[model samples]
Structures are given as structure tokens and as C-alpha cells.
Target: MQQPPPPIFPIFRSRITCAVLTHTYVGDKEHSITALAAATGTDSGTMAREVSRLERAGILASRHVGRTKLVRANHAAPFYGPLRDLVTIILGPAQVLSEELADVEGIEEAAIFGSWAARIHGESGPTPVDIDLLIIGRPDRDDLYDAAARAKSRLGREVNAVVVTRSRWEANKDGFIRELHSRPVVAVPLPHGNAA
Candidate 1:
């Protein structure tokens, strides 16, 4: 007779499950229970119980590496893709914003700038909480403002941005655009009509 599947975990447990999977699959690292507990902000006892449950469900494997037991994803685990997607969602706006801007039109290049850019470039005191976009495009000022508004609505916070036409950008070559590109950039390609 076929054995019944394990019971589904609660939403909180689902988050912990996704975190464990990310460390195992995408991170591609073996983790001790203590490390997994710390990463997920859960207690060691809870982590142990969860790991044992996952192991029984055949989604994870454990091996004794010296005195420590190392945990990793089972290569044949069925939940790998869904688990990865959940992690992407939990990691928040920086990754999502980058993905969305990659589809915007008329933008030749886009980067996060200002204080955030400085921090990313390792020249800063602290990282800015909000995203700052520097866009190279020919978008009208009103259109750019509307886009920023929409992004703010979707992200639940102001998305500080500057959109400069290619001509204006080139003319002010020694200014913000040049300084932005001088730093380590997280570039996203915009659609052709949107190119600045």
C-alpha cells in the first residue's frame, strides 16, 4: 500500500522551510542545526524538530561531519523550485525592482544611486533604506513622475528616482550620471523606446 504524505506545515513553518531550502540549494552549503536556527531566527529545538520532519519527508538529508550534523537539500527534492521562489519573495524589493526595471522601455541603463549607490560602492557610512533609481531615458518629466508614483504604490514606499534624457545625460557627463557609473553598478536594460 502507498504511504500517506506528511501533513502540510503552517505558514510560519513554510517560511522556515523555504529558508532551509535556500541555504541548501541556492546557497549550496551544508549547515549545522545551530547555524540554520540562527539564520532563520528560530530556536535550536524548533529547528531540530523541523529538520527532522523534512528529513522524514525526504526533502532534506543529514550527515555527521565530525561531531556536527550537517544538513542539505536532497537533490531529488520535489519542492526545490517553489522553495526558491519563496526565498526570492522574502528577500524583498531590491531583487524585485531590478527585475521590473529590466522591462521598462526607453531606458538604456538604470542604476541605484545617491547614498545607496555610495554604500554599494563601499564609500558610505550607512545604507539608505529606500531605493534610488538613476534612469537614462527620454521619458517626459510627467511620465517619469507617474512611473515613480506607481512604483511607490506597489512597493509601499517612495522610490526616489531621476530620469534624464540621453541628450541631457551626455551634456551633463561630469555630473551625477558619470559619478554613478564610476561606482559599482547594478545595471538593468530598459526597452528600446524607453532608452535615455
Candidate 2:
């Protein structure tokens, strides 16, 4: 079998760690560990342990409210700003896209292609200045633009979405399309609740 592709960012011990930190740092003000676990497809016990580890690192802070434990990035930590920025730059685009496009209709497949995806797949290059989202299948035009706008705002980077027909994508009739097919592409995830 072909060896798995190297991780985009190997700083985190696991993808789950990156996911946990990304959600906590970039998504909301606070989250319940149970909710975070469910969101990241991790078990609750493991999520709790991960949270505790982050808390010990001072990268996360938690408050226990009766039986509810709420977790959030520790803004008070000295390294919080850099740490947050790091995760945001690395994983924020995918997270933002999923959130914005979750309700968008008729998306058969979606992904990040071009430079951002290239960087994620371990290619050495300058930091990507924008995100290229390839959307296959017909989706509502206005809704797609609206979602891209919101994602751009959150990412602090431009998001350029190209609508491609399923037939065009599958046939790969041109140099550009074939080039995309040859490169590393990061699949844009559907929201957990909406995954088919």
C-alpha cells in the first residue's frame, strides 16, 4: 500500500488534538467537552483527557458550573495569541467553510484546491494568500456567494469559489482541471449533522 501522506501540520500530537484546539480557539466562546467530542468524532472520555492536557498546558481554560464543564481557549495565557493564530491559519478555512456551507443546497462535492491545499499536503511554499474552494454540482448562486463572503471574513483571507459542473470535473478536459486532479486537495467536510 502507498504510505499515507504526511500531516499538514505535525505540531499537534494527533489530528484530534488539532481539531479540539481549533474548535475551542476559533469557533465559539466556550464549549462543553461532550459537545466538542461529538463534533470531532472522538469519545467523551478521550475528549475530557485531552481538555485536561490542554488545561495543564495553559492553552485551554475551563470552568465547572455545577455538573457542566465549559472549556475555551485560555486567552489569558502568554502564548494564546500566537497559538490561536497558528491553528486558525492551519485549519480555520475548512472549519469556516463547513459552517458557512452546511445549509447550502446541491453540493455534491466540495474541497480546497490550489495553494492552500498544496501547503496543507506538505509542499514547501510561501504562505498561501487565499483559499480556492472547488464546488461541484449546481448550488444556489447567491447562497454560495454569501457563504464565501462569511468564510472570507472569518479567515482574514480571500476565498475564491469556482463552480464546476460534475461532468466537467469528471472528464477533466483541460490543463487546469487535470492539474487540480494531480495535486493535493483538502476535502471540505459537510457538517457532522448533515453528512450523507
Candidate 3:
């Protein structure tokens, strides 16, 4: 069977848009155009243009702070509720998790499972409070826990991770592992040269 198309927010395709949204909503900070540009890794000119567009569309609001223009999400905008929900529950988590796990070692594969996975797979219900992670290799437990803690603070949600050796994962003899692999999981892509 063919898979469904991925969720697309046209604005989110732009670096400036993601950066602006990240700061105002996810990062919970107001940012100047230059600052947002730096944060988003886009040229200041491009960031300024995008911020202008968003401001005019009522998605973001800007005000002068001394000589600098500070911009923030317009919570009163009609699109705010749904857009924030989409960014918060969907776009943000994937990006956040990827960054958090990118430097970790000895992970052959990692995936998000449980309710968050269910929702991403189109099963809808209340958004899950915590993120469930399955690591398919034996990574440093202390380091993994530290990364999970930082990720939790950054994502504003708890992260639960389970690490199993390659042998255990390949065998798939455990009922929990069987069930975990049986469900739809959002794969967490590893960084270049990273084993997982």
C-alpha cells in the first residue's frame, strides 16, 4: 500500500519561518531579526523579509525595543492555536530529538514509539505527555540518560528510553520488543558517520 503524504506547512519549509516559530513559540523568546537570522542560520536579509511577511500576516508581531525590532508569535492570531499545536506536537519534537541524539554513540537504530508514534501514524487522541524512545544498541547508559534529561527540558516533555543490545533486538524474542517493533514508529535518523 502507498503511504500517506507527510504533513506540510508551506511556511515551515523556510529556515526563517522555523527559526521564528522556534524562538517565539518553542524557545519562548522574542528575537530581533538579526538574532533570529543567526539562530535560524539564514541570512539577515532573508530573515527580515520572512519576518515582515509573517508580521503582515498576523502570525508574528514586532515591536521596537530600543533600536532593535523584537518579534514574537501573535497569540491572538486566529491561526495561532492550530499552528502552535502543529509546531509544538509535531515539527518541534522530531527536530529536537534528532539534535539531542545526534552525537550519541553506539546506537544502531533509534525510533519513537508508543502513543506519540500512534498519533504520528494517524491514530488521534490526546497528545502523549512523554516521548518513548527505543534504542537498538547498547549505548552508554549515563550519557543516554543525560541526553534524555536535556531533551526533556528542551522539549518540555519527559522522554523515556529503552536500550537493548543488537542481539536482543535482532532476536525479537521478548514480548515487549516484539510489540514495539510491530507498531508504527517514527525513525530517528542518525547523523552522518554515526552508527545509528
Candidate 4:
């Protein structure tokens, strides 16, 4: 199973293809329903339904190994390349960010809080051109920024990061923090098996 980076992706208003597809497309890896659920912040039932729909449409292919069914993008599907390219171009941020942040140390929690987050929350608007990241913990500034720089390079979007101590994050009752709490904040999951 591939490591997960975020809890969800409300991209394109479809939790269907946006998150799950990008992940399977990444590394051309096969994924089980459980893995897909974890990757997309969804339950197995949801993933199973979506997977069945995509499979019927020939957009995805799957087979069972005993009781575990493994799924992946159907390379044989028509227009597969173009569709993969399109999704990766438009919805690649989550996967890219996940890979970039997986090894960064000192972050107790990380999340996206801005236009992108708004879009993920189903708000109607123009597509966001940047990523607004909030890091709570004392991670190395240089490492964090460097990872952001690399992500920007890969994503063709600027990544702006704000750092706040966990104490301040818990204690500060400022407008900025209030606004963040009021809005839809997309929580980025920490790398699996990494000690927080």
C-alpha cells in the first residue's frame, strides 16, 4: 500500500476520481479498497462503490487475490493517457504535497487553509493557483521551505507556508486563527508509521 498524505480531496466536487485516481496513477500502483479508503479519507464502502463504477466504465481494472481485490487505473482504457495527464495536472497537488512532506520532521500537524481549501470544501470559485499551508510545530524552517520549493517546482504552483507553535495554535484566539477554524481546513495526514 502507498502512504497517504491527506484526509480528503474534494477536488472537482467529486471525491470519486480526484483523490483516488491521482494516487493509483502515481507510480502506476495497484491499490486495494482499504488502501483507497485510507488514501482518500473515505470508507471502504464508498471506495468499493466508486471502484465498481469506474471498473464498469473501463476506467479502472481490478482482480481478486483470494479475498483482497486489488485495483488500479486501466492502462488499456481508451484515452487513458490523456485522462491521466489531465487529472494529474489539475489534481496532482495532494499527491505531490504528500510525497514532499512525508519525510519533513518536526511537524505535529499540517493542513491546507486558503482558496484551495475552500475549493476542496465544495465552494464554487475559480481554480486556486497556489497552496496555503499551515504547519504547527517546530520543524526546521529550511527543510519545510525547501520541500515547499520542490513541490512548487513539480506542481507549477506557489506554496506559501505559515508556521505556528503548537502552543500558540492552541492558545491564540486571533482573527486569523478564528477564520481558519471557521472555514474548511483540509487536514494533511502525517506519514504512516512515523512517530509524531
Among these predicted structures, which one has the highest TM-score? 4
Ranking by TM-score: 4, 2, 3, 1
- Pairwise TM-score winner, candidates 1 and 3: 3
Q: Which residue segments of model 2 deviate by more than 4 Å?
A: 1-17, 29-50, 62-72, 75-86, 192-196
C-alpha RMSD by candidate, in order: 13.4, 4.7, 8.1, 5.3
**Candidate 2 lDDT over residue span 28-47, tens digit each:** 57989999999877788989
Lowest-sum lDDT 10-residue window in model 4? 2-11
Model 4: C-alpha RMSD to truth?
A: 5.3
Best by lDDT: 2
Report clashes for each candidate as comma-separated counts. Answer: 9, 0, 0, 0
Q: Candidate 4 clashing pairs?
A: none
- Regions of model 4 farther than 4 Å from truth: 1-13, 37-46, 76-81, 192-196
- For candidate 2, what is the lDDT? 0.83
Q: Model 4 has how many clashing residue pairs?
A: 0
User: For model 1, what is the C-alpha lDDT against the true structure?
Assistant: 0.61
Q: Candidate 3, residues 51-151: lDDT per residue as tens digits?
A: 88988889898899788999888988988877776676555665567777877887788888888777656675676788999888877788788888887
Please give, for residues 37-151, the per-residue lDDT of candidate 4 as tens digits: 8877778998898889888888889999999999988999987887776666556666677678888888888888888787666676777888899888888889899999988
lDDT of residue 98 for candidate 3:
70
- In what order do the candidates fall by lDDT, top score first? 2, 4, 3, 1
- Candidate 3 vs 4: which has more TM-score: 4
